[model samples]
Target: MTTTNKNIENIIETNMMGYASYVLLDRCLPSIEDGMKPVHRRILYSMYLQKAFNLTKSANVAGQIMAIHPHGSTYSTMVGMVQKDRHSIPLLVGKGNFGMYTSRDLMPAADRYSEVKLSDIAIDMMKNFDKNVVDFVDNYDGTIKIPEVLPVKFPAVLVYAPSGIGVGFSSSILPFNLAELCDGITNYLRTGEKTILVPDFATGGYIVKDEAVFQRINEEGFGTVRIRGKAEIVGNKILIKEIPYSTTREAIIDKVVALNKSKKLQEVTNIKDLTGLRGMCISITARKNTNMDELLEKLYKFTPLESTVSANMNMLVDGLPKVLGVWQTIDRWLVWRRESISRGLTYDIQKMTDKLHVLRGLEKVLVNIDKAIDVIRHSPEESIDFNLQAEFGIDEFQAKEVSNMKLRNINESYITKKIKDIDQLEQTIELYKEILKDESKLNELVIKGLEETKESFSVDRRSEIIELTQVKPVKLVEEVQDYNVTLHLTKEGYAYKFKGDQEPMLKPGDKVIKVFETTNKAEVLIFGSDRVAHKVEVKDIDDTRVTSLGTYLPNMIRDKKIDIVSYSVLDKKHKILVAVYSNNRIAKINLEAYEGSRKILKNSYCLKQDLVDLITLQEDTKLKIVTDKSKLTVHTKDFNLTNGRNATGVYASPARILKKVEVA
Candidate 1:
C-alpha cells in the first residue's frame, strides 16, 4: 500500500522523537539514583562478574563488557579507562600509563598496555547487585541479563560529577569532595534541608566562593562556578601550582606565550614549564621592576588558568530525564535506598527458605539411612527424584537436592550441621524482617553504609573555596607610569606624540593643525569630519621615533572614513571650547558634561557640517576668522558658554564665505 505524504511525515516525527528519548534517557544522562550512565554501569557490572578486584588487563575487562555495552568501541573503552584514573576519584584503579591527566589531547596507552581493576569505591558501588537490590534487564541479545542500575551506597555522583552533551539535553556537574558530600547527604537525611555544595576539582585550585552567587546557582540547579589557578610570587618568579579543571598545561602555556608575544603581558622575561612529579608548576619570571600582582591578575583574565565550570544536574530519574537540585538528588537516593533494602530483605528471606527446605529433606534422609540407600542404589537418577518426593513428601527442588547429595556413608555429623544451619537461617531471617519493618533501623543502616564508604574513600579537599570581594577590573592606567608628552595632529591626518620640548620634522604636505601637551596617561579626543569623537590614549602613541609619522586617525576607527578636523586633551580642570565650520559658530561648555570612560562617541559637538578647531576656554580666550571674501571677524563675548553640546550657536559674523579658523 502507498502511504500519503502526511502519513510519512507523522512516521518520521514519531521515530525521531523515539530515538531522541532513548538517547536522552538511556545513553546520555546518568541516573540520579546511581550516578552512572548505561555504559559505565555495564562496565562495572561486567568487572564484578569477572571478580576483577585485583589488577587485570583493561583489554580483558573491556572485551567482557562489550557483550552488555552496545557502543563499546575502542574509543569508548579508552574513555572508560581514562575516566577511572586517579583524577576521577579512581573508581577503577589503573596501572601502567593510563595517559596524562594534565593534557587531555594526549591519548592513553592501548588497552593491551594498561591494567585496571575495581577499586574499593567501585566494589562499594556494586555491593548489593547479587542480593536483588537493583533491577536487572535482558542484554542486547536477550540471552543474558544485566543490572538496570548499580546499588551505589555512597554519593558517587557528587564524588565524580558528570559532564556531557546529550540529545535535547546536557549535563555538567562539578565534582565535590567525598567527605563534604557525605556530610551534606547526612545533613539532608536528618533535616530535609538543602546544603550549599561547591565544586572541588582534582587539580588543586582556588575557587572564588561568592556565597550569594553559589546559593542562587545551586537553587536553580544550573549556573557557572568560578575557579582560578593557584599561583604565588617568590623572588622574581611567579609559580603556578595547579590550574583550573578541564584546562591542560600546554593550553595555559600557549595562552601565556600568545599574551606575552602581543606585549599585553610584557613584564615577563621568560616562561618555564617546571612541572615535575610533585604537581603542576609553571614558573614565569618577571622583568626587573615589573608589578607581580598586576601580572597575576592579567594572567587570570587572559589565560585558561582561570575558568568557569557550568553546573547542570541533568540526569535520569525513574527512567525519565530530569534536572534536579542538590537536595532533590539526595532525596531520590534516599527513596532508592529504601526500596533496595526492602527488596534485598525479601530476596534474602526467599533464599533462606529454599536452603532450609533442602536441609530438612537431607536431615530426614540421614535419619532413614538404610531405606534411602536401598532406594538410591536401585532407582535410576530420574526415578530417584520421583521416589524421594513421593516418600518424603518434599517439593521437587528439595528432592533434587537430596538425590544429588554424595553418599559419604550417611554420617550423623552431617545431620547435626544441617540442623544448626536451619537455626542460623531462622535468626538471620528475623533480623532482616526487623530491618525492613523498622524505619529507624533502615535509616541507621543507610547512614552506616554512607559512613563506611566515607571512611574508606574520603580525600582531602583539592579546591579551596574562599570569599572574594567584587572583582573590579584592574585599570590599565594604574599600571602605566605617567609622563608629560606633546600631541601633534597634522592637516594631512597624521597623529604624533613627542617629548614636550622636541619638535617633530614634518613632511612636505604635513602641517601641524592642532597641538596639545598632556600627561601620557591622559585621553585625547579627536573629532572627525563625521561628527564622531574617537579617543586615543597618549601612551599608546609610538615614542621610539619622535620624528616619524604616528598612526592615521581614520585607521584608528576602521568603520568610518574621516579626517581629523580638530582635537583636544580632556582635562577636568578646564572648560571645553569648540569652533564649528571655520569659526562661523563657536561654543564653550564644562568638560564634565561630555566626560565619559568610552573610547568612541558620535555627534560629539552636534555640528550641522563639521568641526573646525577646539581648545580649553581661558579668561582671555579669543578667536579670529578669515572669510573667503577677505573679511575678518573677531569675537569673544558673542558666543556664550552652553551646557548642551547639541545646542546650535549663532554665526560669528554675517560673512557666509567662511575660510579658516585660528585660536589666539
Candidate 2:
C-alpha cells in the first residue's frame, strides 16, 4: 500500500476518469451555483430525500435515487433531470411531462409518466435547507449518500464561474429570483451599474442582444449569455416562444430552421418536424405582415432563439484552479454547508450524549435488584464469595456477575429524564450548530426567525406570502349607454332618428331612425340603397336617389336608348286587304275574304308596279268581278274585286306604295 505513488502529495487526486468526466459533464452542465446539474442535483436531492417534494412520480424520484444514489445511472439521471429546456434550472419548479430540448426522439417519459413535484418555489428552496444551507456527500462506497447540505436558503443570484483545468474544474452558478434577482441585484448593488436587462428564465425566453457580453460575463470570469426567445404572434404564426440555456428540443428545432435560413425568415416557411423524444414545435409561418414586435426585436437581435450563456470560470479546489464569484459561489457552498453542519451536529450530539450516559448507569444497576435478591436466596454456600463482596466491590471473579445478571426493567425516573433530555439536546444542537456558521449570521437568524414568526399573525398566510398591502376591489364601471348609432347621410337621402325614449315617429325599423332633434341624433341607415330607406333604419339620412320612373327606368333605359327599334321587315303579299283600310276606299271591308284569287292577282302586281317583279298586267288591265252567292257581275275595267267572298275568283287590288326599303 506504500506504492500508491508514495502518497501522491498526500492523496485526493483520483480523477476517477476525471471524476467520471466531471460527473458526466456535471450531468450535461448547468449550475455554476444554481443552474442545476448533476442530474438536477440528483433529482432535487431525490425529492428532498423522499418526503417526495410534491411527488408526481418517476417512481417517487426513481425509488429515491435508487436508495440514495446507488450509482447505476437511474434512468439516465431521470432523463436529464426532467428536461423541457431544463428551464435554466432554478430549482426546476414542477408541472409534469418536462421532456423536451427539440427531439432526440423525446426520451423523458418515466416517473410513472411525469409528475414529480416540489415547487412552491421548490418547496421554498427546500425550507432553506432546513436552515443549515448545504453539505452532505458520500455516495461511492462510504454510503451516507447525499445531503452534503444544499437546502438552498434563497438570496441566490449566481450567474456563473468556478474553475479547474487538468481535465477538471467547471461550475457555473445559476439560481436567480430572489424578488427578481433582488431587482437586478438592487441595480447592481446600488449603481455599480449593470443593466441591459434580460434575465427572466424559468425556461421561457429572451436573453440575447449583447449586454456588453453578459456584462463581461458578470465582470470578467468568462463570457457569453445571449439566450433570446418568446416570439409568439400565433395567427400569422411566428411561434418558438421559448428555449435557450442548454437548448435541445432538437437543438431548438435546428436553431429555428437555422434562424429561418440565416434571417431570411420571410416569415419562416417550414422547419417543423420536431423530435427530441416527444418534444418539438418551432413552426413559424408569417411570410408577410410579420412585425410581431419587429419579429421579437429580431429574435432578440439576431437569433439562437436566443443564446450566448457561457461563463467558464472553472473549478478544482485543493488541487488548484479557482476563479469564482456570484457571491463567491454562494460563499463556497455556504462554507461547505457550515462545516458539514458542524461536523454532523457534533457527531450527532456526541452520539446521543453518549447514549444518555449509558442509560444513566443503567439506573443504578436496577436499584440494587432487591439487595441482590436476598443475597441469592440464603448463601448457596457462601453465595459466590458473598455476592462478590456485597455487590461488586469484586471478589470470587466478580461473583460471576451475580450469576449471569439479566434484570433489566430500566426506570429510575426513566433514566433520570433521559439524562435531562440529553442535556437539552446538547444545547439545542449547539444552537443550530452556531447558526450554520455565519452567512451574515444565517441571514440574520433567518430574518429574526421570520420576524418572530411574522409577528404572530392570522388569516393563514402562506399562499407564498405575497400580500404587500391588501386592498384589491374597485370595479364599478356601468355607464355604457352611448349606444353608438350616429349616421347623418343627407346629400338628399334624409335621415334623423333618436330614441332612448319616446320620439317614436321615426319609422325605419321602428326602434327609432331619422330622429335628430339637433343631435340627440340617430340617422341609422346601417348601409346603402334608399326608399324610406329600403332596408330601413334611417337617421340623419340624405343617402339620396329618388327619381322613380319605376326606379329610374331601368337605369334610364340602360343610359339613353340609342336608335331604339325592335324588329321590322314588312313585305308579305300586298293584295291582302282583310278590312279596316280607312282613306283607301276599303273602310272596314273584309267582304268575306279570299286567298287564291290568282295568288291575289300576282300579289297585286307586285305592289302596284313599284315592283321587284310580276308586272304582267295586260290581261288584267280591265278586269272587274263581283259575286255574292255565285251571282256574278263582271266588267272589263281596271282590275277590281267587289262585293263578295272570294269575289268570283281572281280580281285583285291592293297598292299603296311609298317604297324605300334597304336596311341591310
Candidate 3:
C-alpha cells in the first residue's frame, strides 16, 4: 500500500510539473522567435491552411482555428487581433465592432456576426510558407502540421508588443514605432551603437521622459514609466485630447464624476467625455473664478489622467521562459533571421542546381533528338533511362527527364527555350551560395528587408514623450477660502443652508433645527430609517440653494423610502450618534467612528430589530420620545456619549414601543 501511494505521489508531481511547463511555454507566454503565443500562431496557421484570406465570417475563421486549437476562447483571442485601438499593428481586418480604447464597452460582437480576414502584415509574414526556413510540428491531435514559429521578416515582437501572464512569470513588451524601430536596428547593425527606445501606444498619450527608466527597460528588461493624458486650458474650459495607455477615457470621466460628487472637484462645472471616432477628446468646463491651475492638478491627482505602464519583457526563448530587453531581443531576432535566410538560400541553391542539371541533360538530348526518340521507342520503359545514360554519358536522373518527355515537345524549339535559362539560373545559384558564405552580405540583405518593411508598414509615432518633473499640488478649497455657514434641516427632512442670520425656510411641522457653524468644506451626517448614515459635503448641499420648498433629504439620498430621521452638521464638539430602535432602546456611538473612504455606513451600529430613528446628539440636546400612552422626555446632555464605538444604553420605558421622536 505504501509503495502504491508513493507511485501515485510521483505521478501527481509529474503531471503538475507538465501542466506548469505547458502554461508557461505553450499557453500563456509568446515565443521570442515569432512573437506569437501558441494559440495565436495556430489561429494564423489555420487561416493559412484554410485559405481564409478573404473577408469571411469570424465564426468561420474561429471554426477553422478549432481544428488545431479547440481552446474554447479562440473567438475572443481572434477578436483581439483586430482591435485596432488596442494593438499598434492589428493582425486581422475585422468588419464589425472590435472595440476601442476610448469606450468603456470592450466586448465585441459574436463571431457569427462579424467578418474578418488576415491583415496585410500577417499575410506578408507568411509569404514564405513553403520555404524550408521554419520548423513544422504536429498539432494537438496530430491531425495537421503547423509551423513551430513563423519565418517573420520583420521584428514582429516589437511591433505587436504582446503581453501575457503565466505561472510565476509575465511579459509586457510595449509597442514601438515601426519606422523608428527599423532605423534603430539598422543603425545598431551598422555601427554597433545602441539607441534609447520608448513605447508609443496606439492609444496616444504622453509618456514621461525618464532616461533612467527607459535605460533600465532597454538594458535590464524591466521598468515602469508614467503616461499622462494631454490636457490644456482652452479659454474657460480644459480640453483633453489624449489619455494614458491601458485606461479607458470613460474611466477618467468616472473618476472626475466621483471626485466632483465628493466635492474634491467642485470647480469642474461640466465634465463631458466627447471621445468620438477620431480619438480621445474629453472636455471639462471650469466655473468662473475657479483656480484653473488647481483644477487641472486635481484632475491629474484624483483621476486616471496619468497612469503607470510597466514593461517586464519576459518571453519564451527556445521553449524556456527568459527575460530579454530591447537590445538582446533584437539581437536574438537578427540571429534567427540570419539563420532562417541562410537556410532558405541553401534550400534554393540545391533546387536550382538540380534544375540546371536536368536542363543540361535535355540540351544533350535535343542535340540528337532522333537518336533519343529511337532509344525511347525501341528500348523497354525500364531500360530506357539506362540506355539514354549509356548513349549520352548522362546520369539516371537527367536521362529519366529526357526519356519522360513527349515526342512533339522533344523538338528543337521547346528544348532550346528550356535550356536557354540555365545560364541565368546558374548565376542565381552561385549568388545564393555567395550570400550564404558572406556574413556582411547576409546583414545587408536583412537591412534591405528592414527598409522594405519600414516603407510598407511604418507609421508616425502616436504617443509623445515629455520630461518628467515634479508637479505642484492643488490647494484644497477650504484652504483657499473658508465660507462659514450654518446648516438647517426641518423635521420633514427638508434641508437649508445660509451664511448669516437669515430666517430659515419654514412650514407647518417644519421648524428649523439649526446646527453648529461650519465651513462649506464641512460634512453633514444624515441618518436614514434604513439604518444607513450618509455623509454629504456641506458644499454639495449648499450648491442646491433650496428654499422653502427645500432640497428634500430623501431626494438627495436618491431613495424616497428612506425617510431622514435625524441630521446634524458634524463638528468636533458634537461627537456622539444615538440610535433609537422601535423597542424604546437607545445606543450611542461617536461620529468619528464612521470615518472612511466610503460615505455610507451600513449595519455598523446595531444588529437589533428596526432602526426607528437615528439622532446625532449634541450637548444641551433634549429628545421627547412619544409612545401610545405617554411621552418620555430624556435630555441627551445627561448621557455619557463620548465613546469611539457602539455602546449599550438603557431602555427609557420597557413597556413602551417608541413611535416617534422630536426635539424638546
Candidate 4:
C-alpha cells in the first residue's frame, strides 16, 4: 500500500479509538459523517427538524432527539436547541428567551414554557427535504428513523459547528452567520481564494484588513488573515475604538501598560484605572507632542492591540479527515444538501402517494358494504365463507351467488354502483401529486382546489410561510425636571447661611456659611454719665430659639455701683442713684430712673435738664505734666567786645611806609 493509503488507514483506526484522524481524501463513509458525538450538534439537529418542520414545543423536539442521539436529552438541552435554532441558524423561527451573545451567563429557558415555530426563512429551507439534501441515522435501538444529514436549503444560512476526531487532526468550527459565510464563499468563488477575518464571538467585534487572505482560505483551505481595528487620535493622545476578535478587555489593558513601561510607546504619563468596565475605551495621552499616525502604526506593529487569525479548512467527514478550502467546504455542503433533499422528497412523496391509494381502496370497500350485507342475509350458511372470499377477491364463488339470488334494488348490486366512484378519486389524487412536484404549481393548484372544494387549508399551513419585516419603535426624548440647590453670591462672595444641626465646618472653598448668635447683648453708649438701655431683638434665627434678651446672657451687668437697684415692673424698669466717675474720681452725682409705663428714662444730671449740671466739677483734681528734661539744657552766653582800631594805609611815602603801615 502507498504511504498515503497507510496513513489513511491509521487515521481511521485512530478515529475509531476516539482520537484525531487524518484522512487522505475529503470524502468519508456516510455512517461516520452522520454519526456526530457532541451534544451541541444533536441539539442543533433537533431544533432544525422542529423549526424547519414547524414543531410546537421544545419538549417535543427533545423527545425526538432522545430517540436518536446517544446523549441523554433533557429540557435544558431542548432549550439550548431552540436557541441554537434562532441564533446559530438564521432560518429558525419562533421566539422566547434565546441566550444572549454579550454575556455567557444566559441559559436558555426550560422547554415547558417555550414555544417553537419555523421562520419563513426556515420554512423555505425546509424545501430541501423534498430535494433530499440531508442524511438520516437510525434510532438508538437500531430503528431507521432520525435524519443523518442536515437538510439546508441552498442560498440558505446555517451557522453551526461540527466536531470530530481523526488520527492526527481534530477541530471545532465556531458558528457563523449565513450572510458572512455566503460572502466568504462568493469571494472565494470569484478569485479562487478567500479569507475571513476571524470574528470575535463573545464581544462580536470585527477586524478586516485584507480580503485576499480570506479568499485564499476559501480556495486553498489554509491561509493567514490580517485584521486591523480603528484607532482614534485626539491631538497627541491615541484612543483605540475597537480591538480584534478574542482580545479580552484585560488583555488589551495589560498590553497597553506593558508597552508604556517598556518605552515602546514613549512619553506615556500613566495608565489609568479600568474598573467596572463593560467595554474598553482606552486613552493614551502623550507627555509630549508626537506624530499621531506614526504612533498608531507603532501600536499596531508592536502591541497585541492587533492580531491575526489563521484560517484552516480542515474538518472531519465520515470518520476521515480532509483539509478543505473555503470553496471546497461550501461546494461539499451544497452537494450534500442537494442529495439529502432529493432522497427525503422521494421518500415523503412516495409515502403520501401510497396513503392516497389506501384511502381510495377503503372508499371502494365502504361502498361495497350493501353487497356484503345482501350476500350475508341470503346465504346465511355460507356467509362467513362468502364474506372472506369476496373481500379477498375470490371471483369464482361470488359469480355463482350473483346469478342465483334475486338482487334487491338496495342490495349487493347497489353497493357495486357506489364502489365505482373510487376510480375518479384515484385520478384526483394523481393530479394533486403532479401539482405538488413544483411548489409554485402546487400553490396555484391549492388555491384553485380551495375554490372548488370551498375549504380552507389548516392554520398550520398559514404559519408555514410568512413575510418578515421588523418594525422598531422610534424613541422620543423626554424632558425631565432637574432639581438642584445652587449657591448664588450677592457680588460680595457671601452666600446665604446654610443652617445645620451643628455649626458647619468652614473652609475657604466651602459654599455654605453658618451664623451663630452672641450670648450677650451689644451695649450702645449714649452719653458718658447716662447708660443707654436698649433691648436686643433677634430675627430669622434658624434651628435656635430667640430669647427676649436676643440670646441667653450669662455674664451681663446692669449696674456697677447699685445691684439691681429698684428693679421694677416685669417690663425691664429700673431706678438707681449712683455717682458718675470721671478719670477715677467722682465728677458728679446722679439719680437715674426708668419708668416702663411712661416709656421714659430720667437722669438728674442730664444736660437737657440743666447746662450747669452738665458742667459740674469733680471733688478732687490734680494736673500731671509730662516732659523730657534730661535732653534739655539752659546756657548763658556773653557777646564779648573788641574791635581794634587799625591804621590807615593811604597817603604817603609816607606813602610807601604809610601805605605799608596802613595795609598792615
> lDDT per model, in order?
0.74, 0.41, 0.79, 0.40
Instruction: Give per-residue CA lDDT, model 4, range 423-504, as digits (tens).
Output: 6656655655565465444334323322322222111110011122442322111122222111111211122222223333
Q: What is the number of backbone collisions in each predicted candidate, taken in the order shown? A: 0, 85, 0, 40
Residues 1-664, candidate 1, lDDT per residue (tens digit)? 9855668788899999999988887777888778887777788888899999899988888888888887755434445435532354776777876666666565687888888888888888887677888879999899789988888777566667775677678887667788888887777667777789877888778998777657755676677888898999998789999888868788988988876776566667788888756766899998666778877887888789888877788878878877777667777778888888789889989999888887888777766767777777899877998897777777788878767778873557876676678889888888989998987778777887888878988888888886667664764224666777777778776777777677777778789877777777777777777777787676666673665767666665544566667777775444556555654565665555566645677767766644555665543356667776665646556667676765566677777656666765
* Cα displacement (Å) at residue 517, model 3: 8.6
Clashing pairs in 1: none
Candidate 3 residues 607-658, lDDT tens each? Answer: 6556666666555577888876788788776666645333446576655688
**How well does candidate 1 score on lDDT at residue 608?**
66
**By TM-score, how accurate is candidate 4?**
0.42
Name the runs in model 2 displaced over 4 angstroms: 1-50, 53-83, 88-115, 118-224, 227-243, 246-277, 281-304, 307-324, 359-664
Candidate achieving higher lDDT, 1 or 2? 1
* Top candidate, metric TM-score: 3
Off by over 4 Å in 3: 1-3, 7-11, 475-664
Number of the predicted model whose lDDT against the real structure is largest = 3
Off by over 4 Å in 4: 1-37, 45-147, 154-158, 161-167, 172-177, 180-211, 231-241, 267-291, 362-664
Instruction: Give the higher-TM-score candidate: 2 or 4.
Output: 4
